[model samples]
Target: MVGRADDAVWRPYEDGGSLGWMGTQGGTIARDEDFGGLARLTYELDDSRSFHALSCSVTGWLLYHRFFDNAAAASAAFEEMKPALEALLTQLPEGGPSVPGNARLGGPILAAFTVRYG
Candidate 1:
């Protein structure tokens, strides 16, 4: 199930556990877990070197994760994708913010920490 987010590329795991990067986030890697068979994982391209994960419910509009990177590279990536981001924002619902304002964009660093801490 390969898909594109602007210029980045992603795909689902062989077991259908998680959707991950194909060649965009450095290389091929899959993040797997029991997604209750109802998870929708979306990768938003932040730049040429980075991206964010927007994990949501397949049956509802509930957003589970909004991972972001705060590195200089990520900042530059965000700037590069600002216009697209704005366009995305315009497509949001009218009532309120669809995503949390301070969700952490899990990346390599955060993944390492998660493995080590939990």
Candidate 2:
């Protein structure tokens, strides 16, 4: 569901609560039409990497990813934050805003990851 920087819909996460992870400055919500109504809630970090929780209306599962400068870093960060991410995942609501099946929510995170690693 990721979009190019020029085309992606980006909005800051306004909810006023700590994300329960370190180095997180804030987060953004991204939406796109090509990802089966996937919404991505992505958190910005002090480091070059970022974290995300990808959700859709059809499933309660939250896909987690750590977008880092490199695969090595991503892997390491994923490991370091696995427990916290899992806990966060449990707390996220199921079935976000209703959108078309082709819509995607995590456009910015997906776009950034693709550009940096793909």
Candidate 3:
């Protein structure tokens, strides 16, 4: 259910290491799918195509941002996916949030994922 397209960028957590983990590996943009409601170009740690994303608060904050190996695709993908991803957030469950071990949603959610070469 998870793979890559022909286009993906390869940017790391470099150019300006933030904290201890800044220089560490960023992550693979398995898909341009959306899982969480991160506004700053973020995605779930796993299962971008599903609501079964598992991550603690800390990990969730580090959601991956998908990029493209090509500039044209990059802009297009970002533009197209941003609104779609943001809209998903508005459809979250009415309750507070999922428990310790549960899918983010009670049903399946259609999401798009983007990724880089890394």
In TM-score terms, which candidate is top?
3
Q: Can you write out model 2's per-residue Cα lDDT over 2-95, one digit (the tens) per residue?
A: 2123433323223324244432323333311122232334433333334433222213333434444444554444344433333333333334
Question: Which candidate has the highest lDDT of all?
Answer: 1
Deviation from native of the Cα of residue 5 in model 3, angstroms: 33
Model 1 lDDT, residue 21, Cα: 51
Q: Model 1 shows how many backbone clashes?
A: 4
- Candidate 2 overall lDDT versus native: 0.35
Query: Model 2 residue 79 lDDT?
Result: 43
TM-score of 3: 0.37
Model 1: weakest 10-residue lDDT segment is 1-10
Model 3 per-residue lDDT tens digits across residues 1-118: 1122234222222332322221112433322322232333322222232221111111121244343444455545555655544454444343324443224452343223222212
Clashing pairs in 1: 67-104, 67-105, 68-104, 68-105
Give, for candidate 3, the lowest lDDT window spanning 10 residues.
Answer: 52-61
- In order, candidate lDDTs are 0.35, 0.35, 0.32
RMSD of model 2, in Å? Answer: 13.0
lDDT of candidate 1? 0.35
TM-score of each: 0.25, 0.24, 0.37
Q: Model 1: how far is 22 from its true place, Å?
A: 5.8
